[model samples]
Target: MTNPTPGQTVSGTITVAANATDNVAVSSVQFLLDGQPLGNPVTAAPYAASLNTTTSTNGAHTLSAKATDPSGNVGSAAGIAVTVQNPTPPMTCFVLQTSVTARGTGTVQTGAFSTVISGEVLLAFVSMDGPGGAAGQSATVSGAGLTWRLVGRANSRSGDAEIWTATASTVLHNVTARSAPAKGGYAQDLTVVAFEGATGTGAVSTGGAASGAPTLTVTTTAATSLVLAVGHDWDKAVARTLPTGFAMLDQCVDTAHGDTSWSEYTNQATGPAGTPVKIGATAPTSDQWNMAAVELLNSGS
Candidate 1:
């Protein structure tokens, strides 16, 4: 009761201490939480007990202590009220829920992808028509009762690759995307992937290229982050292996414009600061391409 003062907010493991001075020699002291014995009684000075706040509910708690003399006389200290607020454990890794891919001209809509948990993170990678400019074409995604934000993009005459993200409060089904200046003849490929346990924030690092292979690299702040790499092939080639150490999420081809788009992700943590996560430049080298990457963080990162 002396360590955690009344109305104090505590988290993690904390020590509960008390003082007892008996007229006769104090035989033992016992600490209690909400009138229950905290641990074995202490027979020495500096009476205290270790309490893990995480084990208790995150609300008001009471602490008190009792002391006894040899004659069985006991004295109890007035209970002191305190609050427990334990931190949420950090997510060890991101769990893949579902992914959907699509191809079409103008506005692109992905097929339905389901998730069992709410507050899940939805990442959409869209390969849209880029007229070879300094920047990639801007596109917006809608659906899942969430607000989408563009993470990064890579633009080239071949095509444009972009990464967008949102947090779904309810179950998500389909997603729709359209370029800022919609063009009927401009074809696009969409890949929507969902994961649970993300913080729903922007990428820790982003990288892309207008042609050839991508040299985008990201150094993850947390080991639990999801590293996403996407590319758009202007040649409309759909058959290509993903970079080493990454698992393919989804890929699509828009035959109308002869453009193909593919996405891949890895939950593995890139080592130290100097070491970075990257997509190898070997695959999909036959075509002019645009590549983009984003690293979404895990919860408690």
Candidate 2:
């Protein structure tokens, strides 16, 4: 058997594969889950089935295969024990932008703002007004007793933008932003745009890394309903590779100057509980302007 190994945990749809041998030429092979037949018997090699585990109970189950030969002989393999898990609940995300403010000529700026809804996970994007040419200039958004993770970066006609996320409520306080070597020339205006979501009975977790490269990897705690985002400072053409069990949600590219670019990607697929989400970029340089973030929600079961 190639899937649903003994003690393996499964959810959603899973592929099962098996091989059988018999004397006097094998006539057919039949697969079963918990003693129930799965489709019809197979008379050829590479026997397989796509089984949806959502219909079964959220616990242990058994899988077996029986083979019959043309000589009227039959043989069966011992049942493989597997665990079934429930699917994660769907999530809805929204975005809201705040009024703009000036960051002055200093390298660092801090301010406070309130969220549109109470008790929602906030993914804040800070846009800076610019004639911005300062390399490695970055921003941070934080509030509600937690510092948000920087998952994205972009450049707008106004300036540069940094994206951050955290689990908090409506009233955010002491949100801060800082840039290295001070923003030169004209002072830039800063605006906050937030992406929020209500996880009803589910929880959200966020994290990221900024080592100045195209790819970033983050770890998450939720086994299901997992979502992820990766933000890079430069707008180079890049692709995202997700860890197992996660699927792509969206990929975005924004550039203010043709040479400088910012990009972000969203994914819904993640591995089982306690698994680290590894994200990769196609053409990552040793630039220290890249970051990644992840958000996870439970199945609400």
- TM-score versus the correct structure, for each prediction: 0.61, 0.36
Q: Lowest summed-lDDT stretch of 10 residues in model 1? A: 173-182
RMSD of each: 17.0, 17.7
- lDDT string for model 1 (1-301, tens) is 4566677677777667776888888999999988999989999765667898889999898999999999999999999998887794433445566677777667767665556455678888887765554454656677656678878777644467778888878644343433332334576777777776587644444444444564567766655556787777766555656657787776665565566777777747555334467763466555666777777776642
lDDT of 2 at 128: 38
lDDT of candidates 1 onward, in order? 0.68, 0.49
Tell how far residue 279 is off in model 2, in angstroms. 2.0
Local accuracy of candidate 2 as per-residue lDDT tens digits, 74-173: 8887889988877733433222223223334444344654433334455443433344344335455543466566555543222454556566544343
Give me the candidate number with maximum TM-score: 1
Instruction: Give candidate 1 regions above 4 Å deviation.
Output: 1-91, 130-136, 171-181, 202-211, 236-238, 253-256, 272-275
